[model samples]
Target: MRMIAAVMYEQGLPAPYAESSPLKIEEVELEGPGEGEVLVEVKSAGLCHSDLSQVAGLRKRTVPVVMGHEGAGIVREVGRGVTEFRAGDHVVMTVGSGCGHCSFCVNSRPVLCDTVAASRGKGVLTNGARKLRRNGQALFHHSGVSSFAQYAVTVPGTLVKIDPSVPLEIASMFGCAVVTGAGSVFNAAQVRPGQSVAVFGLGGVGLNSVMAAKIAGASTIIGIDLNESKLPLAAELGCTHALSALDPTLVEKVRDLTHGGVDFAFEISGSKAAMTTAIAVTRKGGEVVCVGLGASADLYQYAHTALVSEEKVFRGSLMGSCVPRRDLPLYLRYYQEGRMAVDRLMSGTMGFDQLNANLDLLDRGEVLRQVLLPNG
Candidate 1:
């Protein structure tokens, strides 16, 4: 098969992930599934900031890679020995593909699987060969699912099977933002019912946090973001309070609403100030989960006074602490039943050629959650 993908050569400099090399869509031959791998004709792929982060060199990963992880499509081909899925199954790609025997994979934290370098990164296929190439050069699949292209090859476990009734556009977002954002709260934070919660950023993850907070029965679900354009959507998603990211009264307002502080706070924006304020706005002994990918290590720092006295619990959650095959289908059901309002999170649909145009919105402080429909 011949497919076009957004390939990155170097990182840093462009907004929404600096592209050391501009992502150009070009035709490349795709590898057939060898063993336990399935080939999906990407129906819809969500363009995540992480993809931008990698291109911009913020998110740590290999380059000369095809960018995109969250995607949904139909299984057109299956590798030999694949028992669970057959061609024609509707599916969403997972970033985490475990060996199913490693301690991390066995412990239900496949997202943290230790063999990340060996598999599930911006490289060639798991079989150690190129799946796609352009002009006699190798083009790697970023995070194992270069869904930005028209087709992708991945392991069976790396895909979450979904029902055919759900629209591919909605299903695509579930592959990442929905699962990561919502899962971080309900699964990682284990948010208690009636607890106070605040989420920073109202993009895909932040909005998912709001929905998850509502599902978790949070009493005060506050959403903060610089874009006043996003608050209306945030409110529709069950955010009880929306604060301007620039408002100086933001922290105090959250504290007042929660009657002291929120019990759980999640920082989903890739902003240093948001991360610090998220930790600060939470009550004593509260938990703060960092869900966004900031520029670098220097982007994050904490004060001892805020931690020692309050007994604040800080954790870096990767992929919502998810076991994808377990969480993806679960969130899919939420969307299918109209309980999640996932359709509300979409910002706009852009054609594949407009990818950079869509990504540029992230740097300009626009775009809530955007997806690219190559099929469109």
Candidate 2:
């Protein structure tokens, strides 16, 4: 089948992406699902910072790849040996696909699965196949989910069946922002009642972290970001205090607000300076959960002695350290109960024509979560 899709042929295009046009929209060939794969008609996909990183050349990926990983759609067909999902089932696509036999998969850590890692590194589906083509030439898959197109063929391990009642646009965020942000609070940080929390970066992920901390009963939730526009929404989403990341006394203010420092700090901005602020605002014996992806070679500098003596833990969280099959439903339940309020995070929806311009908006920190209706 031929479908309209956004294809990236190069990386590190100069900014003003509206002009650089890193992603080219064109008609491409999509193959049917093979063994253990499923064909999905993508209803909605989200433009995430990770996508921006790939466009800006901060993250390297195989060229000529369909560029989207966060999406929700309906399963149109199931391939051989696939019994868990079938035609017409609503589902959300995730980046963490695992070979069921791997140690990480068996240990309930599919995000770290060895097979998925290798396949992602090579930009192919977990089964080691490329299902996208243009002019009879193969195109690489993005995180096993080339969802920037109207349809996608992906492995079952990367999809989770969801309630049809949920809006596909809202559900699209669960794949990346919600899962990674909320999962950090619920699973990685494990904030308990009365714990103090600080979130550095008030984008979709950081806002979700704020909501999750509120749900987890955190007494104080501090939202930090360089964009003052996001501060109001952070407050609306359960942040007790919203502060500028650029403040000269930001660390001191956070420490004073939390009566020393926060129990857990989440770094979601992918900025090295934000990571430093996250670490500085965490109390002794506290933990700093790093959820953002920065440049491949960027190294975070911190006080090693303080890390050892204070027992402050700096941990890396991928896809929220989530087991998609187990956590997606639970997070969806939170959404259903009206506790998550994810809809508020959406900036707006756009089509392929505005995709590049939207990237410029995201680069300028003018939006939170932008949904792409590929089928439209």
Candidate 3:
């Protein structure tokens, strides 16, 4: 089948992100699933900071790679011998395409699986050798799904079944940010009732953190962001308090509000300074969970030993420590029962071509989440 996808290459560099063209897209033929693969007609794809980094050349790339990792789609065809799913099953890609036979996969920690270097990391076909291409030139596949296209040939284990009633367009965000943010709170931090917490950055991920923390029974959920534009939105999304990220006394403000300090602080801003603030606001024995991939080489130069001395648990979280098959339903149920409010998180619904333009809006801090509805 001929499918449209955004394809990248190693050609352009050292130019403005707006113009330093990284990749190009058009209609290309898509292949059928092999032994254990499934063909998904991607219903929606999500935009994440990680994708922006690679496109901007801030992160080294396997250039010529398809830029999407977060995708939600319907199973159009199941591979031979695959018993887990059939055609028309709504699902989200788990990002990690683990070889189920591997030790890490069996344990449900495929995110850190060793095969990233060989399979998804290499842009190869499922066999870890063939590159999906056009006109005899290699076309890179970014993550497991390369979802910035109409259809995807994916390994079965990487698919997480989701509730069909949940709109696939908005549901796609959970494939990454929602899972990352909410997972960090419930699974990673496990904040008990009345706990105090702060999420620095009110983007899609941070907002989820705020909402999750509120649902976790947190008494205080402070939202931090430089954009005054996001403050009102944060308040409506269950944030009990919010402060300008630029406040020089941001940490002190949190301390005064929480009366000592917050029990947990999440670094969702992806800014080095916000990261420092996230760490600074945590109380003794508190947990500071940093979720953003700000820069690969960037480190929290703060005293690591200081955390140990204070008995605080400082750590990083990935994909929200998610078990998607289990957690996706939980989030869906929360939304269904009014325990979580996602209706306001969507800034706009747009066709797939509006992706880059929506990202441009993200750069301007114009919206919380811009979703691409494939059929919109």
Candidate 4:
């Protein structure tokens, strides 16, 4: 089928993407689902920082690719041997696509699945197939789910069946920001009741951490970000304390607020500086969870002695170390119970034509999350 979708021809275009328009909307051909895959009519997709990074050349992908990873949709058709779903089923797609037989997959860590991880960067399905084309020329998929388009073909494992009652626009975030953010807190950090927590970077991911910490019964939840515009929303999303990342006493402030640093510090800012701050704000024996995916060339420099002397634990969390099939439902339950706030986290919603404008806002940290309604 031929459909209109955003395609990236090149990366790192100059400011005012309106002129360069790195992601160009074009009529492209979409392939149907093959064996073990499904075709989805994308209802809504979110503009994430990771997508912006790809546009800015911070992350590389196959050019002429449909560029979106976070989305929710209705199953239009199921491929051969697929019995778990059928037409009209609502679902949220996950970025991780693993070979079912892999050790990581069996261990409940599909994000680290060897084959899927490799295939994602190569711009193909887990089965090493391309599902997009333009004028008979193949176009690569983005992260195995090119949701920027009207339709997407993905492996069965990449999707998690969800309650159709859930709004697709809000549900789209669960695919990336919510899962990665909340998972980092509940699964990776495992914050207990009355524990103190601090989250750096108040984007969609960091804000979700703040909300999860509050729901987890945290005594204090601190949010930090360079963008002052985001501080207020962070507070509204359950942050007990909001501070500027620019404050010279940023670390000291957190230490003071938590009365000797927080028990858990989450680095979701995707910055080396924020990673340093996350470590510094944690009390002795505290754990610092790195949740951001920054530039490949960037490095986190720290004193190795601190790890042993302070007994501080530093861990990297991918996809919130989430088991999507299990975690996605749990998160939705929180939202249903009003314990989580996915709706308030959404800054705005726009049509697909405004893709670049929304990307500019995300790149500037001016919005927590912007959902794109393809059919609108």
Candidate 5:
């Protein structure tokens, strides 16, 4: 099949992506699902910071890859041995797919599956196949999704069937932002009633963390960010206080607000400086959960002595330590019940023509949760 898709041939392009135009909109070839694979007609794909990192060369992947990881669509066809999903079923495609028999998958930690790690590192499907091509030249898949097109072929583990009633645009976020952010709170931090929470970086993921904190009954939730514009939405979502990450006394203020620091601090900005601040604002015996993906070589330095003496835990959360099959539906249920309010995160929708400009917008912190209507 032929489809229009955004293909990235290089990384670390100059800023003002609208001008540099790192992503080229072109017609590409898509192969049908083979054994254990599924074909989906993409309805909506979200522009996430992780995708931005790839564009900026902060994260490296195989070149000439279709650049999208979070999306929602309808199953158009199912390959052999796939009985869980059928044609026309609504689904959310996640990058956190795991081989179900791995130790990580069996323990409800598919995000850490060994097979997925190796495949994603090589930019191929779990079964080592590349289903995208342009003019007979194969293109690498992005996190096994490659959803920045009208259609995608992926394995069943990468997809989670969803209620058909949910809007695809809203459901798109569940694949990454919602699952990573909300899952960080519900699964990683495990905030209990009246626990104090602080979330660094109020983008889609941080905002979701704020909402999850509220749902988990956190008594005090402080939202931090460099962008003042994002703070208002954070407060609206569930933050009891919204503060600038640039404040000179930010740590002091958070500690005072939470009466000696928060129980859990989430770092979602993909900034090492933010990670340090997140750690500083966490109470003794508290946990600092890092959810953002920064430059691979960027090392985070912290007070090791304090970490030991205070018993503070520094943890890295990938895909919110989520088991997509188990958790996405539960989070969707939260959205359905009106407790998550993820709809507020939507900035707007875009098409292929607006792709590069929207990347600039996201890079400049000018937008939040922009969806690409590839089929439109």
Candidate 6:
């Protein structure tokens, strides 16, 4: 079938993406799902920094790829032998997929599966097939999702069925930011009620961590970021205290605010400095969860003795150590119970025509979470 998609034809485009138009909206050909795959009509997709990183050369990938990972859509068709989902089902797309028999997939850790790792790195599906074409030329898939288009062909593992009544725009964020942030708190840190917590970087992901900490009954929840503008939103979401990460005494202030140090500190900014600060703000034997995705070459540095003597735990969380099948519905129920504020996370919504403008806002940290209506 014919469809329209935002295709990244090249990388390292000039900034002010609203004017440069890095992704070209063009007519493309989409193939129907084959065996074990499903076709979905993407209703709401969020513009995430990971997508921005790809277009800005901060991350490299196969060019001419349809880029988007955080999205919610309705199933339009299911391929043969697929019994888990059918037409009309609402689903949240996950970033990874794996062969079911693998040790990681058997244990509900698909992100670590070699199949997902190899495919996502090459911008292909789990089966290594390209389902998109521009005038008969193949196009790479983005994280096996490629949801920036009106329609997407993905494997069943990449989707989790959701309640249809849930608003697609808000549901879109569950795929990435919510899972990464809340999962970092609940799954990675195993935060206990009444514990003190601190989150670094108040973007969509960081703010969600703040909300999760509050839901966990944290006594103190602090949000730290370089941008002052994001602090107010952080407070509104659930942060009990907010501060600029640029302050020379930021770490000291965190320790003082918590009456010593927080029990748990999360680094969601993907910056080396933020990671350093996250580790520094934790009390002795405290746990620090790193949920940020920075450049591959970047590394975090800290004194080696601190790990053994302090008994501080440093954990790297990927997709919040989430099993989408088990976690997405858990989060949706939290939203329904009014315990999670997924609605407040979205700052704006737009159509494919406004894609470039929204991308610019994301690059500038001018929006928390923006939804894209690809069908428009």
TM-score of each: 0.95, 0.99, 0.93, 0.97, 0.99, 0.97
Between candidates 3 and 5, which one is better according to TM-score? 5
Cα lDDT computed for each candidate against the true fold: 0.81, 0.94, 0.77, 0.89, 0.93, 0.89
- Residues 207-292 of candidate 1 have per-residue lDDT tens digits of 99899889889888998988898898899889998889889888888888998898888988768888889987989999888888
For all the candidates, what are their Cα RMSDs to the real structure?
2.0, 0.8, 2.2, 1.2, 0.8, 1.3
Q: Please, what are the lDDT tens digits per residue for candidate 6 over residues 1-376?
A: 9998999989889989988899999999999999999999999999988888888887788878998898999999999999999999999987945667789999888768987888888888988888999988899998999889999999998999999889998899999989999988988898888899999989988888898888888989999988999998889888899999989999899999987788999988788888888889999989888888888677779878987899899888998888888888998999989988889889988888898888888888888899988996
Number of backbone clashes in candidate 1? 4
Q: Judged by lDDT, which candidate is best?
A: 2
Clashing pairs in 6: none
Question: Alpha carbon lDDT of residue 189, candidate 4?
Answer: 90
Worst 10 residues of 3 by lDDT: 11-20
lDDT by residue (1-376, candidate 4, tens digit) is 8988999999989867766799999999998888988999999998999888889888777788888998999999999999999999999987854677978989988788989888987999888999899998899998888889888999888899999999999999999999999999998998999999989888889988998998889999999999887888788889888999999988878888888888999999789888888889999999999999888787779889988999999988998998888899999999988989899989888887799887877877778899988877
lDDT of residue 60 for candidate 6: 81
State the TM-score for model 1.
0.95
Candidate 3 global CA lDDT score: 0.77
Q: Residue 228 deviation, candidate 3, in Å?
A: 1.3
Misplaced by over 4 Å in model 1 are 13-21
Q: Kindly report which residue stretches of model 2 are placed more than 4 angstroms away from their true locations once superposed.
A: none
lDDT of 4: 0.89
lDDT value, residue 279 of candidate 2: 90
